[model samples]
Target: MTEQSAVLARPPLPDDGDLDLLLLIRHFELALLDLFGQGLLAGTTHTCLGQEYVPVSLRPLLGADDFVFSNHRGHGHYLARFEDPAGLLAEIMGREGAVCRGVGGSQHVYRDRYMSTGVQGESLPVATGVALHLKHTSPGALACAFIGDGTWGEGAVYEALNIASLWRLPLLVVVENNGIAQSTPTACQMAGTVAARAEAFGARHHRVGTTDIGVIRDELAPLVSEVRLENRPLVVEFATHRLGPHSKGDDTRPHDAVREAEAHDWYRRYAQSDADRFARADEIQRDRMAAIVREVSARPLSRWEPCG
Candidate 1:
């Protein structure tokens, strides 16, 4: 009967299926990092902190027959397609039970037929070759390769881009520009926009801000769809943020109190607004986070072993 309650009850909150996916992804990343604290990991790891939704939206566009080639920071991409979280944790830990059987550490994790190479832009040419093969065997399937802004300097990417366009390969290149290549920011390193570089190769291109979930769904859906439907190569640039440090090794930056406050403020606002209608989303997030904690706790760190 109160005015405030009436306003709240006027209509339910917006559907947040995508937001739910993001919550689960955040849980995954948090859990993996916790494992590192428990001494379950030996080699280095790259985190996809603020870039969860981009991969979540893009994953649905992929067909089961499609292939994905990822970069160093690719925990999100692998989890999007594959179901075995345990194997992923194991892979990062370098255990025999890992998805890649401990052979590939953080830089070389692979499983469920999905893979990420340590060498920057290495996957570009590999994915181009995969696309070429798919063109012959399974023309309907598409191949997606995810590279970071830092890797723009690599020669392999240009070679792959040139060949993919020349042959019209059915490949999707996603450049996740999180503003930094380690400590070096993109503004300092990138000479030109990634989309422009891809355009130079004659590839179809689109640039999307990853922070705006709505834009991500709208812009990327068609690019992914067209690549699958038309069997042609295309590239999408996702501008995102690195909410956390680059990795465990580096943590010496001056704390931006203002930025931290803003992040916390936004998080509270989103949580409060979405809690009423998208109740399941919140519940799923909480449950998944608990599950991740339990899973990591149950696994012993002593089992971890680097590749012989």
Candidate 2:
């Protein structure tokens, strides 16, 4: 781990609200795995797992008017933005209250100003275009897109960045650099760092090593403001971990790699450092998610009608 990431290996845990949000995402993801394991759900889902803090930290920083484009592993992104776990759960489970009427399932959810897709590198260009629109139509509202480090390989990402930089659009790219992409280690696929790539396109780059929500928000607040005020493209890369498999049962890392990821996980660190606080919060969310699963599963399938 980087020295910066080590700065908060122990917990003087975040405020209650932050802790709750983090655990909520954690438990929601855990429930997804359980549901998948038991054959309770169909279709594919990607859980953010250890990287939940990325969106949790940015939730308060983002405005409702700002556009958010999410990638495959974006449950954290959605939950953090809307805080409507029931809707998301229903969407995933194909229940009556689904956000997208059960058609989008896990990856292709759409709500006002927030959208997510299963395809890699697909959202950036769309986000870039939206940023341009936000720049002209809604001055302060920016477009933020979450992408994995593996997405750096896509030429469309670079194209989007070039236009975003040239047009001085309010584009914020959050890169979750989890070291591995699907079954491939990033070291095996990436030639240069995400920072270097963003710099090459004249977009500003910021590295986030610490998992502390307050610290991350404080650090990025100014940069985010810069994106809004100056209308420049910024890439904030998080040195994060993915504790679960790439998808369900698709992890290809060696045993030691998984152990290393676990060591860096914020959940483990917080639980170890302040068990009294962490345990209660974790248990509450876990149980709450369990209740949600039961409730959503019992609901009838959602019906979708084509718009006339």
TM-score to native of every candidate shown: 0.83, 0.97
Q: Model 1, poorest ten-residue lDDT window? A: 3-12
| Inter-residue clash pairs, candidate 2 | none
lDDT of 1 at 173: 88
Model 1 alpha-carbon miss at residue 122, Å: 0.6
Instruction: Point out where model 1 deviates above 4 Å.
Output: 1-17, 38-40, 95-97, 210-214, 252-254, 257-269, 276-287, 296-308
Candidate 2 — what's its lDDT?
Answer: 0.92
- Runs in model 2 lying further than 4 Å from the true structure: 1-8, 306-308
Kindly provide the TM-score of model 1 when superposed on the true structure, using C-alpha atoms.
0.83
Error of 2 at 35 (Å): 0.8
Q: Candidate 2: worst 10 consecutive residues by lDDT?
A: 1-10
Candidate 2's displacement at residue 284, Å, is 0.9
- For all candidates in order, the CA lDDT equals 0.72, 0.92
lDDT of 2 by residue, 94-145 (tens): 8998999998889999999999998899999999999989999999899999
